[model samples]
Target: MNRLSAAFIAILSLSSVAIAQSQPVNELSRAVVQVTAPDGSGSGVLFERDGELMILTNRHVAEGYTKFVIGVLEDLHQPVVPTFTAILHSFSPELDAALLRVTMYMDGREVNLRELRCRRNASDFCIPEIRFASDVRTVSRGNEIAILGYPDIGDDELIYSAGHIASILYEEFGGESVPMWFRTNATISSGNSGGLAFNPATGEMLGMPTSISSDAETSTSLGRILSVEAVWRALEPDRVMTTWEEFLPPNDGLDPAMDPHYGGTELAAGFEPDLFEVEVLAGGSNRIHTLPMECTGYVASAPDFRLDWSGETTQLHLFFEAFDNSDDATMIVQGPGETWYCNDDGSGTRNGLDPAITLDNPAVGTYFIWVGSFGEGDFIDGTLRFSEVSRNDF
Candidate 1:
């Protein structure tokens, strides 16, 4: 009887794994999608695009299937398993990426891609959605990054691995530089081919997961990933990347990101490891790179849904210039669970601490400043600045 009981437990464990694979997605499943390949199954992200498209999965999955199957649980009691039904729309074999259009049109039954609120709006061009890392002010070779996927995993199979970002093949990070690529320890399983690598700090979308830590050979655990640089190049204004080789380009996508003056270095946590020459002064006001906003009369601001920071006295020093006479009302500041730091006075600076503030305390590398209103009925515009540098360099 004891032996039989143990056998039952083993079977249950195996069955549980199967269920996880088929139904519930990992913590990051909101952006995950499973692709049933002729050879085997793999994973991909719900690539952000107009609802007009079905979903993007690893190209090889529906590559051979002219009409692919897409499965989605009609009800919660059913399961998170995809309903295996779709019409192939487009494919790029070179990148091993495929796009399929789901024809079922099941509305009200399940949450669809239309739910994600897009904060990024760079209307100048039509490139793949790329989110800059607001939490990781600086990126290095050792910073931890997680890759989410559903490689040949069974039903209960969802994998999450943390690894150091190793190399910046294309560029140190983002902007109009070369195609971006990063390397990490996170093992890319067979089913995780088209998964996603997210910066856990801010929940900001980084890049699509590709290649395994161990290549076709189960040899080493050197996981590699490509950044939005590759995806952006495919959609640059005039930049035409017709081939994969052309996309990879020749120059190391490092120098520009390391340049503090021109590159979007302020957007990331700190300089990528390769930027040894760049120097960042501590306690310097980051208003230089912050968005320009002015105190526009105060009101009850919805508690910021952002959970990236922990602070007792939340002071906001916006980088703004007085626009006109209407801006004379007063600069007031308020936050949930905290007192308003600045009262609506005609003072140009809101915090009242100083014309420029160095957020030296707590030493949190990144934060977001939401601009709403001044006190009374006035208007102003300013930008948010970083009070502390990620890495302290004289």
Candidate 2:
């Protein structure tokens, strides 16, 4: 061969080697585990929280089954079954996300972290925690992505496919909108559900493989990937760190439980509470805050608030007035106990979409307030007011 041709060939060989070295396929594969339910099998990503291990998968994979088996792919595509038992911790059908917590074995067999023989270490089985992409805004059309999972075609072998983002879709429901999924040409099939879609350049998870679509007349390859934001939102309160002061302040007020409103038998004279104002973006783009109150309810949007009430008596009144009347907004108040309250329009008398809540004999404790837009275009720019009322007001 000529000298120039030989030099060109040498450069191409070196470039291919560098590219292969950059991809951490082995490490990424270790984070992907085989999840088998009573009816079928799929893939899941291993995550660690507070020193305990958990698996993040699609709800359909673990739904209807109280318990399932988690196995790691060993050499020659064989799966090494760990004695660990995974129990369903939480699942959301809307988001298509499920969280499974790993409990000790049922047979009383002791297993150490090093016994799983996961990534990086031969002696230790500790699976490395997968890093999720923080900003979905960075993922744009045509961005290169990769999927790691146990595709049925692989026969229990961890498979990797590289592709690029094709299109993005937003699903709107209950007055909120969010990036639902991204369409891609990534080679995904049965058993690939719940597998992760990551940026090969950064190794940051962007989404999760959920399903694939095909055209009958024309040939097209596209897979729908659920955005990682859904997973992050479902598992946020446990993962994000914040202090009590961030939600509410120390209680300093006359005992209202005995009298109801600040004053007994009458509304408290000049009982005015300061208005707390917050700015929230549309489409649930902000971080969701946990309310100090202990109750069960869903916050449709971010920029939520909490109030601590130790001196409450019988009736509680909460008001939310948004500046944008055209913006359809909703307010939810959950607290004290199992009691929950929500309002779409405050009194239905005002021009703006304001929400008001009145609770009688509310349990004395913290209360959570969530202000959210009803659709994709609404932004939260308003004031939240809290007051105590007499039982008669209710």
Candidate 3:
């Protein structure tokens, strides 16, 4: 082989291994692809093997685009962006999860993409062909989760942000920590939608950052992650990429209770005085904070409802559960200038909350703050649980 080509090969080998075994925080640009359109950018994880290729991002990330041709992780050798045939596998609008299949070049043998190492680590986790993590336990309120994506940051390269698991909203009707969503302190800039948020230990995916705080401020305080359940719901049973496939339901078939996708829920508009009492500590536990989870009516139908906020409450991810027994419909809304509003049908946070979203972000104190059913026809009938609510600044 020519000296130049040989040197290039050596570089690729070393860099891949380096990234695989270590904590390459915010280094998602390494093997992931970005979907750039006229006005936006999205992130996708690179899954290569068996001569087959694909990218995992939010369906909304593609924004109706049908091409995967971006090179990231700057050190890799594919200088010229190689275009791949992109196919939309499945999508769930409400959950905001999507999958794309990319036609790839393969030699004589099959290849599995996970074999490509990016972050160097002491342990090599043999990522299951279908790797996923569920029933996630928040180790700390400020349990940090790093994402791989275009950080809306105008730097023209992939950027990373660290976020704590902020608050978990587990509504009564919506059910179970909304395994579909998570809030974070990570700054998910303009172009970061659809990138991967994963656990460093297992290399198992946690979710993708879908939204970031859009309000104008010195710094944005909140970001959002779409859980794997979103991906499963949008994917065909045959292609569902999680531990869930073995007991895969019939196409589009779902059970309301045991299933992650569907269930009735009662949302907490906000905190009511009689609803809660606080407990401070000299030190904390595995969780940063804990909230109450049982009401009078539906104790038996409840999930864990245990609020585990680790780190300092400010750096913790507090789990919240709300019950709605008002017999009305409600919505969670975010408006401008701290004008949080709730009456009989809605809830919102205008100034942001405290404990802050993570250790880095700070509490955004705005004027508007309400969390109960608003107006008319927005309340409902059921018991709700709230993990905990604390103030934070990111």
Cα displacement (angstroms), candidate 3, residue 308, comes to 64
The residue-by-residue lDDT of candidate 2 on 86-139, one tens digit each, is: 777767644677888777664756545555435554433457658888877668
Q: lDDT tens string, model 1, 1-394?
A: 6999999999999998656544322324544556663324666655445555356555545534455444332232333465535566665534555566655533324434444332353221111343445433246677767776666653524566667787666554234345456777776766676667777654455666766544456667776665644543333334332233333322212111121321222322232341222121112111111112322233222221121334432332323223343443222222233323332332335433222322323323333222323322323443323332322221
Worst 10 residues of 3 by lDDT: 282-291
lDDT agreement with native, every candidate: 0.44, 0.65, 0.44
lDDT of 1 at 208: 64
In model 1, what is the error at residue 295, expressed in angstroms?
67
Better of 2 and 3 by lDDT: 2
Taking the tens digit of each residue's C-alpha lDDT, what string does model 3 give over 1-394?
A: 9999999999999998767735444333455566654225567776644555666777556533444444455333222143334555445444566666654432224334556443353233222232456645443356667776656454546565566788654432223334556788777766677787776655567777887665566655688887665555446455443322233232112111232111222223232341332221111011100111110011111121222222222321221123323233221112233222222222232221111111122133311111222221232232332323432221
Kindly report which residue stretches of model 2 are placed more than 4 angstroms away from their true locations once superposed: 1-23, 76-83, 105-107, 111-125, 172-177, 236-394
Model 2 residue 322 distance off true place after TM-score fit, in angstroms: 62
Q: Model 3, residue 360: displacement in angstroms?
A: 58
